[model samples]
Target: MIADIDGNASVSNATGKPLTKRGEATRTRLLEAAEVVFAEQGYHEASIVKITERAGIGLGTFYLYFDSKQSIFEALVIDLNRRVRHSMAEAMAGTSDRIAAERAGFAGFFRFTAQHPALYRVVREAEFVSPEVLKLHYTRIVEGYEAGLARAKESGDIDRRLDPEVTAWALMGMGELIGMRFLLWERDENGLPPAQLDERVFTAMTQMIDNALAPRREGNHDD
Candidate 1:
């Protein structure tokens, strides 16, 4: 089964009918293939033929799932967004506090980004291929982040003065750029990103986050 933008179970086909287990598997294959094709070749250069070829599925089978290239592209964006957020949430699970959650969540994000560098390329191209999905991607991530930050603020784990919405965006932007600069840009002997983010970079980044979010003590005026 596939998930819609709202995280509901979705058929993910033009027919809107429930898919059998095998059908679900085929749709997943197409999406996986679409990820690589869209990443390697931008939207304009990518074609349904290319995606199907990569999937090793028949060309006619493509339309059964998606009516057009744009539809699949949009679906792929949502799919990637869901998976990445899941990675972060999974890693943050069982953490004791917001600070710990933040570190674990970011570690999860970087790990996924390292494994799927195509995430960066595909999402960036979404701005052109499908602007709405691009917004949805970022908004979905921020919604969860803002909710977490809001809870922390209420519990005195973070600065009460900080607006959760704004802070969420700021922190998300920080993570994206940091990953792009370090993990995405750096490559190993095999020309692949390191399996994990650098310890030094992660420590420095988390320190900055901690200092910014940590609660202010009484009578401490060091702004």
Candidate 2:
């Protein structure tokens, strides 16, 4: 990772010049290092020095691209979100079926989280502590789900009787909570083998969605 000599919040190069190929490479290194640092150590605990060291850059160089460790962490989060949004867009664009889109999108998310468990932990944990980040992340995801739910309802895949916004929120919350429970919260005893996380999460999520979408009993007020 090439460290920018100038302390600026832009992802520029070491010379404090425009972002060339080398500059972009340096920026990528910084973001990648930030991801690892934030994942291994919580945001508050991570240091700019550590991040720079991880990126193989000097502390001054670190400052050139990011004002502080917080900025770098935010950049990492933004990058992750961008990747997720891109993946979802690709899945949706490729398919006309809502169910297929949801399944593919969720599977992509699951795979991404599985591969970057540490980074996911950093972002997930940061949400409550960082309202700005939370809002940004939630808005992107919620909008996507709402749009998806609308499509599903139109296609007769989802129950049009239900409020699409509310239903989408419920489904999103379920998937997130379940992912956290099975992926983030797993200790030694609770941890499934790495290979099983995807299948287990998918099965659990599918079952939960199925149960929620099933017709309620006459006396049941439960969702």
Candidate 3:
């Protein structure tokens, strides 16, 4: 799970010079190619030539956007993180409340995961290939999530006892594992992951979330 906190893409090239429209497009092409190549071949096996070949760009052109394979790999992680966060935010838009927002947001996440299964592999590889980017990926998602949870807590929409930061990480972990099981593991007869998470699993997951986050009643007591 990842999201761009700043919502800004790089406007310059590797040399610290502003990129022209064409240059930006080429950079995007390289990043896109890197995403697939890295996902398919682990960082140890992936090469600049492979990425350039996949992008149909020359070897020399690759250096203009990324100084090395590691650089491009890091960039791809950020790119995927930004895009996935955007997908969640887009789905969450106009929801009535935090609970609704959670449902929509998770739905968006699973949808993107289905379309871009590379996110899981590439991110996992980042743990070894570039630990810092891996941290950035999770931190970015949790930052936004914590902010939202804090707002909900202030509004009394969620359990006041819940620590926003802790709850945010917990919920993110739940979503991550659930997506891995239902979206990444399951396959159709066509040998592709489902286009969306199963409604039954979604319902069960949300019910659990609602139970966890719902405010406690004054008279309610549990041993």
Candidate 4:
């Protein structure tokens, strides 16, 4: 399990308190250091020595907290996923409609990517290149999305013929595709004001999501 406040072993086999202040501090430092290192250099290129140096800790100290650089990377991904889920939960708590919920959810996601560009890059890379990491990061969110689809079906909000699981995954894919385009700067652009660029991107995303979920008109329900 996890450790106590003084940075000592709090658990003797099983029973113990949370991490000590020093333990927690060390943990935070490692995570911060890993985040920067992983962001600066892709996961394959990042080294334990670099991360420890950034954390200002010894190599043995790194092992005391984590097994390997891969473990730390997994921890970082899990941490980011938790933060994203928390943000989505907060946004969803106030909205009932699916479209409204998606809008708020995507807005929160957009803000997160805007704020944590490096982390976003890491997540995007993992999606295409690391199946294990992708599943680890996405399983919970996919479960929740499936639940929403079930609700939509029950309410006659979605076509009863559509598989909820497939629909949920498709929705997730759509969001990720849009996010990659917006945040990755995949297109070539020179110097521009950051604020204007952010605003333009945010507005474009809001419109994209709106159009994506717009209600089908009577005659146009040809699907």
Candidate 5:
């Protein structure tokens, strides 16, 4: 499970109570089931029965935590939001430079995408199922990215001219689209997405980010 900045266990139930080991496992199972079902069926067609069935739980068990289909879907989105952020944070940790952090962060994102292909599809459904949840998904990502970029700029790690919030959104847009095209769409002979980013493409993309975000040199004339 993910944790707060203070390092406390972050797993909780619908009542906001810290979960027992068993409760945490159950919630995780339901969310994982929802991920697969939502990605396969989309929100409009995916029902609570399907989620519970996939989760191998009875109908009554679902209501113990979530009230309805919409509730679970929203919860799923929130859960995914936490998870992806953690993935990015963990990857960027201890990297030597801002560009290195960016490359590592995007690598984490694509790794999650390859394993949980449901990410793109479920987030897209949030546009109709719950617009606020869609915004929540994006804003959470931007919050982390903006904070990191702000620090990097202050430390002379990245271009000071770049606005942290704007740069965050731009970099997020780049990562999502790249994951969609290269990771989601690329398939092997067995019709499965590759488990890693292509090395050449990763290097090229990181070079572009380095150029865009690198601090301007004193002798530089190009805008």
Candidate 6:
């Protein structure tokens, strides 16, 4: 991550500016608080005061990191987007095959979603508040996914006929909806989403993915 000396509320991706350990900690706190405030109050209702209170920081300190409500909101989205992708990438890292990688990636996604329900809310709100950032989120994920899928296709890891771009988007959409249903909407007695997807459900979803992306043979029913 880089820094913007120009004083953006959040960190920038371009410059290689480094923050002190305390500065990084403070920034993390602000983003976390913003997550809770946005999830509970929605973008329009959330205020700087509320975020600072939730973060246990002062108004002046908030300015040091972020300039306004929107800036912080955008930062929050970026933070969530980066973390979720990291989770997926890390999970997929050691997988031995394309199918395993996909399954692991989705598992990571759901895990992050369950742990951070605010992700869904903040992203949806970005459509209205910051559509560009919203696009950045999906496009960034798809770029990395397309690269991996392209490599897998070249190596016969997945169906050679599959278009990497289309497949990447389709898989992402599938994961999003499935996560929304199983990880976000499905709740326990206390009304909290499960920390992990059920084993049975996970198996069912992975089976479907395997069948969908696996290459076809002459005797296959789809043929």
- Highest lDDT, which number? 1
- Between prediction 3 and prediction 6, which has the larger lDDT? 3
Best of the two (4, 5) by TM-score: 5
Point out the worst 10-residue segment of candidate 1 by lDDT: 1-10
How are the candidates ranked when ordered by TM-score, highest leading? 1, 3, 5, 6, 2, 4
TM-score of each: 0.95, 0.76, 0.93, 0.74, 0.91, 0.90
Tens digits of per-residue lDDT, candidate 2, 9-35, equal: 455533456676776788889888888
- Backbone clashes in candidate 1 total 0
Q: Assess candidate 2 and give its TM-score to the true structure.
A: 0.76
**Per model, how many backbone clashes are there?**
0, 1, 0, 6, 0, 2
Q: Model 3 reaches what TM-score against the true structure?
A: 0.93
Q: List pairs with backbone clashes in candidate 3.
A: none
Q: Which stretch of 10 consecutive residues in model 5 shows the poorest summed lDDT?
A: 1-10
Candidate 2 displacement at residue 216 in angstroms: 12
Best-performing candidate as measured by TM-score: 1
Candidate 4, 1-223: lDDT as tens digits: 1122112233111133355677868877888888889888888888999999998999988877777666677666766776777777677777867767776776676566555666576776676545577576677678878897678666756555657788678777776766666655543464211221256665776676555555555667766
Per-residue alpha-carbon lDDT of candidate 3 for residues 196-216, written as tens digits (9 for 90 to 100): 999999999999999888888
List where candidate 1 sits over 4 angstroms from the true fold.
1-3
Task: Answer with 1 or 2, whichever has the higher lDDT.
Answer: 1
Tell me the tens digit of each residue's lDDT in model 6 across 124-217: 9999998878887888789889999999989988888899999999999998988888888898888789999888888999999898788666
Ranking by lDDT: 1, 3, 6, 5, 2, 4
Q: What is the Cα-based TM-score of model 4?
A: 0.74
Residue 163 of model 4 has an lDDT of 72
Error of 1 at 197 (Å): 0.8
